[model samples]
Target: MADLIKRIQQGERITITNRDAPVADLVPSASGTEQQTLDAIAAIKNARAGTITHAEFVAMHAKGRR
Candidate 1:
């Protein structure tokens, strides 16, 4: 646990495994940075099913304000 904390403080990504199978990952919490948003968009694009365009994303944001 101490080692995990140490590595995390150093901005390292850590994967936790059990019996050689990954159970979870320990990543730094996002702070609303632009890179984080881009990474999120990439993840959404890689989703195994549907997609929404940039226009759709903007429309959804606008809709929530009404």
Candidate 2:
């Protein structure tokens, strides 16, 4: 597991498998200079700007059930 994590930290993506079938991925987390982290945060906020609230999601789901 440590070896896999080291490889990931070195920019390698590792795919976990089950019975020879891919099940999950072991990828490195967001890591870099402070600027990169800030950029990522800004991108996430921008992407979520148009998202609905939890209450709005629930109301939409209820409407769809009707």
Candidate 3:
């Protein structure tokens, strides 16, 4: 909807509706400068490249709890 786009551009939070039912959100992506978005994306991409065994991941953070 045009109103939704306008609200998003103006940095206003809005709820999207369909068939009179709220479905999704139309909000600003982040509250930071461009560098933050780039850094976050790079971090996510780098993280996605690795595959860790379940035991390794759990041991790394388990703190001997399990």
Candidate 4:
């Protein structure tokens, strides 16, 4: 588990097993704020929708910075 935490610190994924059965995954640590989690979930939902064109996404991101 210590090694898994080290790997997560280095932005690597880890898997956890209980009694030799795969039960969980350890991913890189997030800031763990509610807004951050919500934003990640929203991004995932948008990605799974798969309706946006590449150009549209680029434009939207660019506009966000302005």
- Which candidate number maximizes TM-score? 2
User: What C-alpha lDDT values do all the predictions have?
Assistant: 0.70, 0.68, 0.64, 0.70
- TM-score of each model, in listed order: 0.41, 0.45, 0.35, 0.36
- Tens digits of per-residue lDDT, candidate 4, 28-49, equal 7566445656865776577679
Better of 1 and 2 by TM-score: 2
Where does model 1 exceed 4 Å of error? 32-66
Task: Estimate, for each residue in 1-66, the C-alpha lDDT of model 3 and write its tens digit.
Answer: 897777676567898689999998877667543665676565556546655555655654463352
lDDT of candidate 4 at residue 21, scale 0 to 100: 96
Ranking by TM-score: 2, 1, 4, 3
Model 1 agreement with the true structure over 1-66: per-residue lDDT tens digits: 898887775568899899999999997666634565686666567543457667766765674464
Native-vs-model 2 lDDT? 0.68
Better of 3 and 4 by lDDT: 4
TM-score, cand. 2:
0.45
The digit string of per-residue lDDT tens for model 2 on 1-66 reads 788877886667788899999999877676543555686566557547956677765665574463
Comparing candidate 2 with candidate 3, which one achieves the higher lDDT?
Answer: 2
Candidates in descending lDDT order? 4, 1, 2, 3
